[model samples]
Target: MKNRKPLVIGNLTARIPVIQGGMGVGISLSSLAGSVAACGGVGVISTAQIGWREADFCKNPLEANFRAMKKEILKARQISEGKGILGVNIMVATQHYKEYVKEAVKNGVDLIISGAGLPVDLPGLVQGSKTKIAPIISSLKSAKVLCKMWDRKYQTAPDLVVIEGPKAGGHLGFSREELETIDELGYDEVIRSVVKLVREYADKYKKKIPVAVAGGIFKSEDLDHALELGADGVQLGTRFVTTKECDASMEYKQSYLDARQEDVCIVQSPVGMPGRAIQNEFVQRVQREKLPIRRCHHCIVTCSPKEIPYCITDALVNAVEGNTKEGLLFCGANVWRCDRIETVAEIMEEFQ
Candidate 1:
């Protein structure tokens, strides 16, 4: 087959079909997103607790998030030198989702890739803005739901669609039982189904909606697999972690370089979702004990302070700060595949 081409999403096209998946709690910020965008890929910055570095982050996390969101996107645009697409990843499960969308649109982000929950009202939020909107779905049912809902309620279709399978990192969309039967569910089959839906909806709305598959896509062959399954592109998370421009600390990057196959596993997120991550000391301890929540940052509305396993915010902050043993090392299912640190340009060459 011929080589895969650039991904066309709405009015923006990425020379590289790879979209650098957004990582949170300090990962995949200005440095990582900007470098990836400069390499002709769609670079995504995660707005999940992005303001942890601000001076009054703990006291006013939401305010810090709003301030940092604009700053990070502006920085990414500058780094790309206006050559590549810069996008933001906002979670539907995040508190004040509309505000986050407003911040990105106000800053003129080229795209907004939202996940962690179905963004039904996303179209209304970006109604008058030029920011292209995309939703991250893990199943064909969710894809149909979003497409049908957006069409009927907002008279618009998604600019792009991201099919994030169970193998992706962070908050997953599948249930624990479904995650176990993912292989039986046949990932290729699911991707093809979503691809079909994207094409169908795109035709119905008289627009083009590109489909991208995420999770366990670490190598060129993996991209080929998704494309062959009818996906126009792929989104990767773990591979970008070891990149030199990654915003994660050296110790954090080292953990990726040093990870073994057995070290990567499916851990339960405090948000009540199953996520892939590196098995660390803190993860193990949290699994065995119910830790207390000191201060609720009002992250996810569904997260009950006393009911969850541990405080995800605190654990992730520890990881962001380079405290490996005490942090939650969220990573993709292909975490073990990352063996060395390379520049963003060099890593992009691997796909070429």
Candidate 2:
């Protein structure tokens, strides 16, 4: 692989094109994100039900979540010596979703990477803020939709686009049948297609929309291949979990260390989305029981807590709080490769 420096993504140049994948429900908070940014990569904090631990989280949702967002951003800024461009990953499906995006902007986030749903109106939410917006896309069609929506409505194109393949961690865009299809979609093919689409969109706008790819990327060869395919950068999430700077509990980290390739499976989430996760006892039980999940009228508007089988917020919080045995263990396909915990610097060195 050629030794090329990482490319920047937003209006302001990033020293490295690496974007820290946002993990949520307490994982990938300020400490981890700040460390990644300080090391010259784009650090990202996951805002998925982020304030589950606040004392008043149940009573005053906005106040608690807002406070957490501010605190975490402030903490990351301090750790980055005020130079790291801190970004937040906010799922468009969340309840009070717009509020979270607005709060992140109010707290001076450098960028917002939204996923889980098509954020057709995200550009409007970040109107005057310098916070760049990058929507996660699973296919070229999704990319086209997002670009068209943003251009027509907001008169602006996305600063960047993240092409997340099926092999990625957490939630996925494909269905169980699609994921289990006889012919699997090749990353190389997907990358080429998406890159071509992004380039075309960029040409029309007369601006470069930095293209980044994510999911199942773990080795130097993967990075090199992505760069060669026209992707300006890469986003990685699971690999960082094993890093020492990750804020997840030791047990949460250990789960990754102990995982085997077969342990990772695409389980059904109560939100009606398919997700990648370690097949632990919790997953087995959910599958076996087909639990009548009722969406707890708490987070994310699209979810009908009453009809959902489990509470996503509670499950993630349990894992973050160290109850991994009974909690949902979301992971990327390469999670099995983790064997030891190292610092962010050490992890980044491996890529270099």
Note each model's CA RMSD in angstroms: 1.5, 1.9
Q: Please report the candidate that would top TM-score against the real structure.
A: 1
Q: Which sections of candidate 2 miss by over 4 Å?
A: 1-3, 182-185, 290-297
Q: Lowest-lDDT window of 10 residues in candidate 1?
A: 1-10
- Local distance difference test, each candidate: 0.88, 0.83
lDDT of 2: 0.83
Query: Could you give candidate 1's per-residue lDDT for residues 1-352 as a string of tens digits?
Result: 2456988887888888889999998899999999988988899999999998899988999999989988999899889987668899999999999999988899999999999889999999998888999999988899989989998998889999999988888888888788777693487898888898888888988988888889888998888888789888889989999988999999999999899989888888888888878988998898788988889987886799888888888888889789989999999888888888889998677765
Give lDDT for model 1.
0.88
How well is each residue in 76-150 modelled by candidate 2, as lDDT tens digits?
A: 988887654689999988888898889999988999999998999899999978889899988777887888888
Task: Give the TM-score (vs. native) of candidate 1.
Answer: 0.97
What is the Cα-based lDDT of residue 24 in candidate 2?
83
TM-score of each: 0.97, 0.95
- The TM-score that candidate 2 achieves is 0.95
**Which candidate tops lDDT?**
1
